[model samples]
Target: MLTRRRFLLALVGQTILGWAKNLFAQTGVFLTEQEAPEAVFPEATAFERQVIKATPELREKMQALMGKFKPSIWEDAYTTFLAKKGGEFLGYAVIVEEIGKHRPITFVVGIQPDHKVHDVAIMVFREPYGGQVKERIFLKQYRGKSVTESFLPFQSVRSVAGATLSIHALARGIKKAAALVQAVYQEGKEGGW
Candidate 1:
């Protein structure tokens, strides 16, 4: 009887553990690659996709602009969308990823022609909690921010109560995005550097 009871208890514990794992492993895909640009550039009538490679020199410039070296932000290549309205260039949008707690959070950062942040949208949120980071109140803080601006928490950027990690990840990701756009499309460079 003792052995039978122990087996039953073990089985129950294993079952509970499995359920908890599944609960936390859920992935939420709020937007797709195509839809993200439309959401970020609502008024734009046209969007041209461009694939930019990350060369050694470009990476070095990005590092200098970002003021830190984060490998996760520097992929082999980046897919960007150039938005236009009636033949007028509006801005660029780039998709970036950063770690939130344990999993990666995908964000679509829209940058204006002047290099300021136009908007930020989350494409995929893998963490179980901290979905509140997607809320407008948290993301709106990024608008109008430039590569020269500070993304530090509680100053230029606001932090969520339980989503501190996610917020920090987003701040870093946005700063990286701004720096990328600056390096690729600096003022008066013409056709980018």
Candidate 2:
């Protein structure tokens, strides 16, 4: 036996879900309303309103726009989401997990699809000294290069020479971010990923 309040609440949830489905039918993305438990990926729990919403129309668009990338259906799914929401896929956040290109510390970064970096937020800094590497002075170097797909060689490409650890941390974060973007791009390759 359900109470009237419980029945109304269930109805509201279903309505919201239906509306979400319809919105994604047109847009392919939904801002996550709250943080999530650790399940989607490491260090990626409780993010800003950023989530994927897939639709038939969105999938088709991703297939056409990024056909050359040879992405999988899943990638298409994500890309479709990004493109439909907006061509840049800006504001999608990820949690930094490794210490490649940098050493002795791991940090968190916020990035956009067009490769635009939002913030190089340091979630954890286990380094010697004042942790100046935790500042944007080193991380800001990654702005605009988020779409490079692969780590740009320190030379030939612009970087903050002064902040070595921070620069490397940003680079490593960028590299990780590029992999996510590339993963979605590659997903349209043929099968699903």
Candidate 3:
């Protein structure tokens, strides 16, 4: 026979275990390499990974071009996946992680070869709220934005009603990612940097 106290304790323990399971299950890939290509370039048949190392010279160039230091989420090196169809370049997909209100949001920014943004997708939104940033309507605003453009929340980019922090974080991240692509791929091709 189980006492009422024992039953209550058991229920609490089960609830804790359930939350623990959810936390552990979320540890896998947020923006997978396989999915980014498909999302950014659905018609593409092949993709290539372009790795850019964050050397001091490269960092200085990026800072100068962006007018600020690189976002902290970026590492010493990062990858930009280029999508192609039969050798015809489609665009590039770059994943950038930014700190949301209380958690990190991992997103993929697709940039065309012309330096304009193609699309934006939230691969993983860890916060309890602010998942609204993933909506198509919100993400569409990023299309065609470039490193030369400014993404001001509530001005150029519409801010989510309750997810202002997330909106700002994503807008900043997108700008940084676009600048990185421009500095490495576009400028390199043009000036042979």
Candidate 4:
């Protein structure tokens, strides 16, 4: 026994869900493997993928280092690419995805060998409100920032007027990725891991 009001509500809910699914499907592979390397390392002649597994000890250390936990972006393993030019190391590039408002935003972050951010590019931005995050003015602020820097939204990191959440999520994701590289790749390599 379905009331008219109940039927109408169900129909609307289904319609919204279908629309969201279609939107997500359309955003598949915003940044392909070929393009990511080029964007992260414009002068690189080759690149290598290194997978860092997040063991229990590693996860605990990351949590301590970041001072905050974001389960969505922090996974059990991360695939980071090392860009090289004629056998000389150029830098590192990592792609991270974080929840923005109701959907996910994917971006690629490039870090120099000195641990400073070289650039950040928005690969997939699903939220319609914060498309401005892709603008150079906003993304440029992240350049030269490192894991040692404070990435607090509206504090160390400037926030967009209408895209506060997106900005915060991007900053946080970048910080996490940088920290991962520092703790796992750089430090681990030095420690003879």
For this target, which candidate reaches the highest TM-score against the unseen true structure? 1
* Candidate-wise lDDT, in order: 0.81, 0.43, 0.75, 0.74
The C-alpha local distance difference test score for the whole of candidate 3 amounts to 0.75
Please, what are the lDDT tens digits per residue for candidate 3 over residues 17-117? 99878655543445565687677677889889887887878767666766653465655776678888996998888877788777778888887877777
Residue 141 in model 3: shift from native, Å? 1.8
Ranking by TM-score: 1, 3, 4, 2
Quote the positional error of residue 190 for candidate 3 in Å.
4.5
TM-score for all predictions? 0.80, 0.41, 0.76, 0.74
lDDT of 1 by residue, 46-110 (tens): 99999889899988888787776364556788788999999899899988888888888998999
**Considering lDDT, which of the candidate structures 1 and 3 is the better prediction for this target?**
1
TM-score of 2: 0.41
Which candidate's lDDT is highest? 1
Off by more than 4 A, model 4 = 1-29, 69-71, 188-193
Worst 10 residues of 1 by lDDT: 184-193
RMSD of 3: 4.4
Q: Name the lDDT of candidate 4.
A: 0.74
What is the RMSD of candidate 2? 19.1
In candidate 1 the C-alpha lDDT for residue 144 amounts to 80
For candidate 4, the 10 contiguous residues with the lowest summed lDDT are: 22-31
Model 4, span 72-162: residue lDDT tens: 5667677688989997987888877778777788888888878788888777877856667777787888887765676656667777776
